[model samples]
Target: MNGTDTRSELEDYLRRVRVALADLPADELAEVMEDVEPNVLEAFEETGSIEELTKRLGTPEAYAEELRTAGGYPPAPSAPTRTVGDRFSARYVVWVTGFSIVVGFFTGTVGGGRYASDRYVVLMLCAPILALALWLLFSGRVRRVDIESLREYQAARRTGRSAVAQLPPNVVEYLRSMQPAWWLVRVVLLGVAFIAALSVSSEAFLLIGLLIAGLVWAGFRVRQDRRVLPVVLVANAFAVGMAVALLSAVISDADSSRSPYVTADYRGSGLWFDGEPLDNIYAVDAQGRQISKFYLYDGTGRPLVSRGDSCEPSGSDLTNEYPKPEVDYTQGGCTTSTNMPVLPLPPTAPVSVSPSTSVSPSTSVPSSAPETAPGSTPPAPTTTG
Candidate 1:
């Protein structure tokens, strides 16, 4: 036979032997396979034919049975017959566990702020389902082997490993190096989510605290036990969800707080004084004379028009005209007045001014005129002729 045929026959023999020993504990079976494989390879290489190898070593199953007997191991236990309910229960546990974990983590992370109660309700509801799943796992009704044996699970595992294997070695190592940092990053994300929720509701403190603790524990456990990897992955997903939720909430708040008049379609018309809207303007000249009508203009000479208060029949319109008509809602009915509601005071009394006695340019006061006494009126100035 060709070398390829011989190698294939050898591999087939080893595969059958492994199947025969499958009931052994994993470590013990591995030890038995290690001892048996080299001897089989040596015998095959020497014999040069499968028929001769089988005559010397017996069939693969008989060989495995001889090894079990020589090792003082008991006979393999018979496979248990699983009922339909058993299959259903295992599948139910798997599905419920996954669903509860994902939904619970999402609700717990996003339930902060105004919807704190919603988080509690969802968690409470999921708790029983999750507890049942855990019980099934611990009770061995749904074994790890059962889950791993599933076609979907095996396919996913193969796909993941294949994808990772396709990466360059250096890139894979770089990603491995980042794994430790991700644990801390997820914790920080949880903290950010907590603070964001706390800004709107104080009730998120306990929920976020528990999540942070779980993340820390999961990180630690995963380092020691690779079986905890699924837990770590779920925690990472939760952190990503938290970050997305926080970003969306922040954007929503910003949009809400923005002024409605800040949009492209906004056209501001009313006048404002010290942040307060002005419905109308009143103008008066320095002499307190009421200026009946006047237009306003800005520094650039743009008409500073505003919608003035309009009486019922007169619709509101933009105008720069000042002293708009006043509308009064009295007990009788609405009344409109174009006249100034507040009358300007009559012009102040004019100061009387007697004309100063004419002083001729030729006339001059004597420089040596005597100073006047305190209370006495100065004697009529004597003519200094």
Candidate 2:
């Protein structure tokens, strides 16, 4: 038969099954009816008693009656397995798998993939526990189901048509080869992730791709092997995503990137990381020529700011973005970057513990030398100013 005719034939088969199964729950209907999906093309190829096939597959009342007689209504039929969340079951295995994926993403993103090709190792570790969870919540999504559930699942599958709509048989078969499709996807994502990482010089993209591939591979392996490759992958992905977000959570001195806080000035010597301006800071001209920039920091773990180096970092006449020590302020009203003596002027010299540490020091008084002062003061109507 031609394409339209073939599809028509398939739909007719499914409609017969659906009517037979109309009284069943969607889960059950989907369940007993799924069999036809795997084998409808084969049926269409033959000329035989579809009636006999339908009879043996039975009706919704018959399937429900069979299920009720087997066990009390199949107990929600275990609602197909998902990649995460409801599947977690508080298992540490899942937790660790999640942990490792994060670790791998991080390592991978930081150009660490070359360090070890052990993504599979991390995933392998996570799979068993996931498999256990799958077994506990066993349904159509898992491996090692009993003969009855398996048989019923198979039967339903055989009864359903390959395509509910007008997809070609070869196309349908190609799509049905889910494992190959998964592997292809995994490879592509990872490859793209790698290239992007190299070009953009950001580990974050690769890490993300690592995660996507890991999850895909994990799910495939877990379901196919009746094992856990995919589960670990999913967990790993989550962990890495978390790590990336946390990587930049250096608590800043303020809510905004505004100043009196930290602002980058194209001028001045670049800010120091260990007493030297960060080498990564760059400078560019109007024509975009590189000269200098500074790596400014908030003095804790926040980002290493890259303020471009300027021959004279240009800004407003009013308040310079990188102010020249508007009296050396620090967060929380600390005058010096660290606690130190601020001696008053003719020169208000800030005696500092660190160039970076800005803390306002407490007052200090010089001790009077015993009673020498007593005699001196009585004598010192002459001076003591």
TM values, all candidates: 0.47, 0.25
In model 1, state the lDDT of residue 293.
90
**Which residue runs of candidate 2 sit more than 4 Å off their true CA positions?**
1-37, 40-265, 268-315, 318-385
Q: CA lDDT, every prediction?
A: 0.62, 0.41
Best by TM-score: 1
Which tens-of-lDDT digit does each residue in 278-347 have in candidate 1?
5556755545566789876653456656555566565567676777677778746776555666766543
Q: What's model 1's lDDT at 255?
A: 90
lDDT of 2 by residue, 1-385 (tens): 4554555555666555454333345445555555545554455455344455446545433544554556454433334333544333433333443455555455434332333334434434444555565454334332222221344434634555334335666676576668566556545545544554455534344444645655666665453232345344554454443334334433342345565334333323244433344323233333333323322233342333223323233621322123222223335542322111232232123223332422111111112111122212222122222
In candidate 2, position 299 carries an lDDT of 30
How much is the lDDT of residue 249 in candidate 1?
Answer: 82
Question: 78 in model 1: Cα distance from truth in Å?
Answer: 6.6
